[model samples]
Target: MATSGDETTAVRGTFGFNAPAEVVFGVLTDPDRATRWLPVGVTAEPAPGGRLLVRGGGHRAEYDVDIDPDRLEVRWRPATGTGPHGSARVGDAPAGGSEVSAEVRAPLDEDRLRRLLGETVTHLRRDVEDNFNAG
Candidate 1:
């Protein structure tokens, strides 16, 4: 719920899936799945002072985590390009599925920011859901 007024600057969304937090967490943190959502290739060195270079998914923002920020919020982006900083947080849903919230800062027009964040969320949800269903 990030939409505020007729002109919002950031876009935040939450998605639920029929999977567990651990299951969905892997989808977001695993480097193998980086290309599925990240803007650029995965270059996280798995350390606190590691170098990260992500420039894909339309936007081109760049930032670093303080040694993985709970080992979950690894996604980063700069404000210059079209990139958005996003992360996936999973929790147990009352109905048994897992809830994943994606907080993205799209530094673009309201329309484009919303659209990009929405599409990114949908794609990630589908991928994780499909993976769960397949198992």
Candidate 2:
């Protein structure tokens, strides 16, 4: 399940996953696992003040990473951009599984933000099912 709020400058979306919170958090924090689901090719340290390198379209840019294990959240912003920050947080869902709430603010329009968020969720689901549900 996915839900979105009405906003133009920023986009907020909640996605439901059939994976546990710890598993979801691990996928976000572990560099090797994260690279499998992240939209772009990224090399991140996954720590506070760590460098996050995003590569796509033959272009590469650096961003700062902020991770909070207690909060189950990770945030990042470009090292040079005026202001396009993004974050993803995982929590236990009401019924079962986990819920991932994501937000991207400024510079990116609502449509683009929604698309990116949706893409990430799709990849995340596939990865979890393939890696975690194998029997």
Candidate 3:
């Protein structure tokens, strides 16, 4: 889901998987796993003040990683623009499933924001199904 504003918009992408929150959170927080689903490449460190870049498609989302179990908030001042900062929430869903929802606030139109958010969540689904959930 996406909403519009004057120069900033908020977009969200939500997904569910039949896995534990810890497992899904690991995929989201781990740079390698995130790259597989969300970026062309990622370089990150696992602590506050540590930086990360999820770059691809001529754009990147740089973040000063502040890790937590249930929330992820990133604020990146993109030097050359074309990046975003977002917050994500991960938690347990019904029936032993896990749900992940990310909210992105950026200086972008609703259409473009929706596109990016959709792609990201879709990619996460694929990663979980193909790599982590494969039988």
Candidate 4:
């Protein structure tokens, strides 16, 4: 994670999953599946105007969701004022699975931001691989 300006922290990471890009993207956009992989206790729901309402850990925010199925990319930003925002792009891994490049920016400390990003990515990979095997 890197600090931008004085307070904002930015985190960028890449993770690989043993699943297709489609599968990863599916899990990301589906509210039920998304909540499963998000940070523990976090909840996500579809909101009006194609936005996503997320609440957890005593924090609540609404984000505008943008998706590009063809590119296997998904992005979200605060629906109103700026706070925390992120984007993930899924691509076919040369070895056969999928690779995801993710970025998150928030006005939080570097350690906290890094921990949150790491936790979410770990959960996302576990949920995606587990569900892929189940199905």
Candidate 5:
């Protein structure tokens, strides 16, 4: 679910996995696993200025990848102008699953922003769950 504030919008999704935090974290950090959940043709360099691009259907998103172990943040900039910003945090969840929370800030209206945030969270949750089950 997503929570909207005055200045920031956050969407948090949790999945209970049949694995430990370290195991889940490893999957989240692995590039091959990331591709499984992230949009198609998505590539992450896991460094500053590293490209994080996603393409699906007719829509595409590009951002700079910034990684900090348990946290991953992306600043989406499709054009030379200012762009939307987003971040994802991975933490230990009760039971055996890992919890991931994502927040995005764009120049879009409230409804559009909410929908985008929700979709992003859903995609990520499904991807993580799929990887966890496959492993």
Candidate 6:
């Protein structure tokens, strides 16, 4: 993913959940499941060219879906900032679970980038854990 203004800065995070690949994929692709763990006020069509909106706690994020059976990628541009492009990929984990990875790019210095990436990874991990446990 490339930042809005700086193409050189890239932030990436990967998380693994103890769920089957299809199950994890379903949770990611299904709007209801997505909202239950990710954000609020969500609406998604789960198809190509469809729009996905997530809003809550005075924060809203919108993205266009570019989906496939094995992957659901979105380019998110938020409402209140210089939004960077975002994409998430779900696949088989190395051990016996599913893994999801997301990348976001923004104009942040090296230290900020590291912190942001860490936070993103933690957030994704918690979300995926919650989704998996809720099933």
Top model number, TM-score: 4
lDDT of each structure?
A: 0.57, 0.73, 0.66, 0.86, 0.55, 0.59
Candidate 3 regions with alpha-carbon error over 4 angstroms: 39-49, 57-61, 70-83
The residue pairs that clash in candidate 6, if any, are none
Best by lDDT: 4
The per-candidate count of clashes, in order, stands at 13, 0, 0, 0, 0, 0
Mind giving the per-residue lDDT tens digits that candidate 2 earns over 2-85? Answer: 234343367788888887888888777666576667666533344334666666546566777788999999998888755556
Off by over 4 Å in 5: 1-49, 55-61, 70-80
Q: What does candidate 6's lDDT look like per residue over 1-135, in tens digits?
A: 334344446767676778766766666666554545442332333333455665544645566555677454444544344544566777787667877787766555656666755655554456666766887
Worst 10 residues of 2 by lDDT: 1-10
RMSD in angstroms, candidate 6?
A: 5.1
> Could you give candidate 5's per-residue lDDT for residues 1-135 as a string of tens digits?
556555555544444444555655666555545556554444443333555554554555665555676453323444344456666666677766666555666555667667665555565666666766777
CA RMSD, predictions in order? 4.9, 4.4, 4.0, 1.4, 4.8, 5.1
TM-score (C-alpha, index-matched) for candidate 1: 0.65
**Candidate 1 C-alpha lDDT tens digits along 1-135:** 564443336667677777777667767665455456532233332323343445444423345542253544445554244444555566778767777766666446767676766665666676687777888
Model 3, 40-73: lDDT tens digits are: 3433333334566555555545666556754533
> Candidate 1's error at 44, in angstroms?
10
All candidates: TM-score = 0.65, 0.77, 0.72, 0.92, 0.60, 0.58
Comparing 3 and 6 on lDDT, the stronger one = 3
Query: Candidate 6: deviation at residue 11, Å?
Result: 0.4
Candidate 1 CA-lDDT value: 0.57
Residue pairs with backbone atoms closer than 3 Å in model 5 (clashes): none
Question: How many Å off is the CA of 128 in candidate 6?
Answer: 4.1
What is the C-alpha local distance difference test score of candidate 5? Answer: 0.55
